[model samples]
Target: MSTYEASLASAAAFMERHERFLVINHVNPDGDATGSLLGTGWLLRQLGKQAVLVNEGSTPEKFGFLPGAEQIINASRAEKPEFDAVITCDCADFARIGDVKEWLPLGMPLLNIDHHPTNDLFGTDNLVRTDAAATAEVLYDLLTYMKQPIPQEMAVCLYTGLLTDTGGFRYSNTTPHVMEMASALLACGVEPAPIAERMLETITKAHVRLLQRALQTLVLRDTDQTAYLTITAADMEQCGAQNDDTEGLVNYARNIEGVEVGILYKEVASDKVKVSLRSRSIVDVAAIAQSIGGGGHVRAAGCTVHGTLADAKQIVEQKVSAALASQEASV
Candidate 1:
C-alpha cells in the first residue's frame, strides 16, 4: 500500500507524465465533488495538460456559477477521447465514477484523489487522505508541492469544495487546516458572500415545491429522535424538479430538534429507491450506509435499496434504529 504522501508524489508524477487527461467525479455531484473535479481540471491545465472533464451525472445547477463548470460533460453525452490517464476526484470507489468508466481506454492509468476513509484505493496511484476535510484540501497540498500558484478561478472551485464538504464550515470535519485553505482561497479573490448566497441560500421555485411535497411526507420515528422524508417520482414530475433540486432535502430532516438520525428515501424507480442518511451525534451513518452497499462520511452517507419506498424504509429504519440502540448512537 502506498502511503498517502507516496501516493501524492506518484499522483503528481502521473499528472506530469500525462499530456491529456480525463477528469471526473462521483455521481450526483455535490459542491465537494464538482469543485474538486473542476479544481483538478484547473490544476492540470496549469501544468499545460489537456483535461477533458466529465461527470457521471449533471452537476447541481447551483454549482453552475463556478468557473469551468460549463465544461463538465455528462457521461451519457460524452464521446470517447484519447487520453494519457484518468483522474477521479472525491469518489470513494471506482463505481462512484459510474458511466464515465465506459469512456476510458483499457489499461489506462488512474490517479485516485479523495478524502473518504472508505476509499477502496482503486487507483494505480491513490491519494486518499481521511484527515483532510475535503478532496480539495488534498489538491491544495499538491498545488503547493508543485510550486503552482492558485488563480482566481481555481480558488472558486477549491473554496467551494471546502465550503460544501464542511457544511459551510459547520460540520465536524471543519478543522484548522480547512479554515486556512479557505483563507488562502479567499486571498485568491474568491468572493465569499456571492458564492455562499448562491450555494447555501439560493433555491429554485421548482425546488421549493419539491421541498413542500417532501415535507408533507415527513414522519418522525424512534420516539421523534429520527426524521424520515420521502420524495416520489410523482412529486418530482409534478414539481418539475430534477435530481439536483433534491440536493439538500435530507438535511431538512437531519436538522430537526432531538433528531439524532435523519433519512431521506427517494424513489429511483418502481422497484428502486435512493437513501440519504444523516446523523446529529454519535451514530455512524456511514457504517449503516456501507452495510447496505453505499458509503460516505459518518455524519452523512447514502445508499440505494432495491425495493419499493416502503420496503426501503423498512430496511433503513431497522438499521438506523439498531445503530441508535448501539453505544455509538449515544452522545
Candidate 2:
C-alpha cells in the first residue's frame, strides 16, 4: 500500500528465496548489531535455513543473555565458511564489516539491510530504510510478513536492539510506530527488566574505572554545549579496560543539559583513534562521521581517525560544532 509496506514485502520475498544465510554486522558489534544478528539468525533457523552469526570480534558480554549468542563466531578465530548468501544488518558500509569483509562471498547474493541513510548499498538487494527508527524495526516487519512466529528469546534480542538504538525510546527516532512495534515484542514475552539489566546493568569493574578516567579528561566546547573525552593506551591499561568497556560513555556527555554534542575518543593503537559522536538534537552527527570516513545514524555515529587522540578530538569537535551551529542558524 505504501513504500515501506512494499519494501517490507520485498524483504520477505528475499528471505523466502534464500535457504542458507551467514549474518554479519559492523565491527565491535553493539546491542543493536548483535541483537539484529541474533534475531535474524533465529528467524532464519525457524524457516529451516542454516543461519550462522559471524562477526569480526567476540560478542559483547552484555548481550550474553540473547538467544544464539554463543553461536556467534569470530571471523578471525576460524576459517571462513561458505554460505548461499551473506546478510549484513545495521552496518552502513563494507568497511564497517571490518576483518570479516575479506570473507564476504564474492559474486553471491548479499543483502544489505539497514536504517542508516549513509548505507553504501553493498548488497545485491539493497534494503535501506532511513525512515525506520532502527534496523530491528525493518526486521520486525519482515518477520511478520514471512509468517515467522517471534519467540521469547528472539523477542529479547529484537527488543534490545530496538531499545538501545532508540536510546531507550528517548531519541528523536522513537516514533509511535516504534512504540507499537515494541509493544508487539513485549506481547511475545520480552521482559524489559532482565533485558534492560542484561543490556544496561551488566557492567564490568574495568568499565567503571574507564568511565571515571574518561570523564576526568572530558573537555567542553561551544560554550559547554559540546563535551568530549579521550582514552589513551596508558589510560586503558591504568583502568584495565578493553575496547568493550568504552561503550555508553559517550552518553555521559550527551546527557548533560545544554550539551548538544558528545564525543568519545579511544586510542585503539598508537596514532589511531576511534571517535564516537552523539547529539541530542540540532546536530547531525552522522554527517560528521561521513566527512571523517565513517557513517551511521544522525543521533549516534562513529569514525576511526588516523592521528593522536588529541588531533582527532579537535577535528571531530570542530566538525560537530559547525553542524550544530548550522542547525541553529537555520532556526
Candidate 3:
C-alpha cells in the first residue's frame, strides 16, 4: 500500500479499536477546525462510537448554525471523560489544542488529522495531507475509505470547512480536487447559498466597528509589497467585538493593491500578540510562522509572540521584510 493508504488504514484501525473518543480542535477554532471536529464527531456517532467534541474556546456565534455546534463543550465545562482515544482535527501541533490537551487520558492513542504542510506528525496515526485544501477534505476521503455515509448534516459541516478555508473558493489552495469534493458535498444535500451567506456575507455592526479600528492601523512596507494592521484588546472591547469578530480583518491589508503579504497583529492580552499572515503568492508564511513556533499553510499562517504589541510588530516586520527581499532576490 502507498504511504497515504497505509496511514489511512492505521487511522481506520485505530478508530475501530476505540469505543470512546475525545475530539479536539485548535484554540480559537476557525471554520475548518470547527467543521472537521464536528464532522468527525458525527462520523464517529454513525459508527456507534461515543465522541465528545471539545475546544479551548467557544464556538463563534456565526458558526453556531452548524448541525453539531451546540454539542461542542468548552474546555472549562468539560470533565475528564472516560475517553479511550483522542483525535485532533485541523491542528498543526499539540500546543494548538490549548488546555484541552491536559484532560486527555495518559497513553491514549492520538490520531492527528490535518491539511497543514507544517504538521509535526504529532499523532500515533498521523494523516497530514498538504495537498488537501482543508482537513474536511481529508476527513471526506477517510470517511469514504471507512465506508461511512456522508449524511446531509455531515456534508454541511464538511462543505463549510472547504468554503471558509478557501476564502469562498478564492484562495490558491482551491484546487480541482477541492472543487470535486465540493460538488460531491452539494450532491449530498449541502446547500451552498445559505452556508455562504452565513459564513461570508453576514456581518454585524460590532464586527464592522472592529474592522474600522483595525483599518486605522494599517501600514505598508517593503515598497508596498507588505501591508499589516493591528488590533488591541482595548479596541475589541470598545467595539463590543468578540474574539471571532476579528476574523478576516487581515484580508483588508492583503486586498490592497501591490501588497503581496498581509498581516494582522492582534493583542490578545497585555503582553501577548497573535499574528496572522496572508500572502497573495511567492512567499511561504507557514515557514515564517513555524520559525516562531506556529504553523499553517503556505499562503496563510499564524504565530503568537509573548511581548508588547510594538515589540511583536517590529519583530514580524523585520521577518516579513527579509522574506520579501529574499523572494525578490530569487526572481
Q: Name the best candidate (by TM-score).
A: 3
Candidate 1 has what TM-score?
0.96
Candidate 1 lDDT by residue in tens digits, 1-331: 4476677788889988889999989998989899999989998888889999998877777888989999998878667777889899999888899988887777789999998867888888888898899999999988887788999999998998898888799999988898888899999999999988888888889889988988999899888889989999888899998888888899999999999999889998999999999999788898999999899888889999999998999999999888877764454
CA-lDDT, candidates in order: 0.89, 0.85, 0.91
TM-scores of the candidates in the order shown: 0.96, 0.94, 0.98
lDDT (10s digit) by residue, model 3, range 1-331: 8899888888888888999999999998889999999999998888789999998978888889999899999888757777889999999998999999788766769999999999999888898888999999999989888888888999999999999999999988889999999999999999899999999999889889988888888889899999999999999889988878888899899899899999999998989999999999888999999998889989999999999999898888888889999988989
Candidate 2 shows a clash count of 0
Stretches of candidate 1 exceeding 4 Å from the true structure: 328-331
Judging by TM-score, tell me the better candidate of 2 and 3: 3
How many clashes show up per model? 0, 0, 0
Give candidate 2's error at residue 291 in angstroms.
0.8
Top candidate by lDDT: 3
Candidate 2 TM-score versus the reference:
0.94
Which model is ahead, 1 or 3, in terms of TM-score? 3
Worst 10 residues of 3 by lDDT: 75-84
